[model samples]
Target: MQYEFRPSGVCSSKIVLDVEGDIVRKVQFVGGCSGNSQGIGALVQGMKVDDVIGRLRGIRCGRRNTSCPDQLAQALLLYQSKNETKE
Candidate 1:
């Protein structure tokens, strides 16, 4: 499945994800710190969604409430919840 998410309290504007079952196939962040966002995307590829969530959730950017990674995790969680509702 493919998903797009808007991130709050961060430089990034959008997150795009491709996931298959429990694994992440791809992640892309729009309008953020290029290197960090790209690196985060690369690192999370092929990782289990839950693992990514566990690692990335609650991450803060500077003094802000959330970071790009955290937003990505939130996106995945939303994805999981939506999928769960389908079953």
Candidate 2:
């Protein structure tokens, strides 16, 4: 499944994900630090969604309350929650 999320409290404007079962197939972040976002997307490819979330959740960017990684985690959580309701 493919999911798109708009993230708040972060530099990233959007997160696009392609997941198969619980594994992440691809990730793309729009409007953030280019290198960091690309690196993150690469690292999370083929990783389990929950594992990604566990590793990234609550990460802060400097003084900000949320980072791109944290927003990705939130996006994954929202995806999971929405999918769960369908089953």
After best superposition, candidate 2 residue 14: deviation in angstroms? 0.6
Best by TM-score: 2
Per-model TM values vs. the true structure: 0.97, 0.97
Candidate 2's residue-wise lDDT over 8-47, tens digit each? Answer: 9888899999999999999999998999999999999999
lDDT for position 69 in model 1:
89
Residue 23 in model 2: lDDT: 100
RMSD of each: 0.6, 0.6
**For model 1, how big is the CA root-mean-square deviation?**
0.6
lDDT of 1 by residue, 1-87 (tens): 888988888999999999999999999999989999999999999999999999999999888888998999899999999999998
* Top candidate (lDDT): 2
Q: What is the lDDT of residue 71 in candidate 2?
A: 93
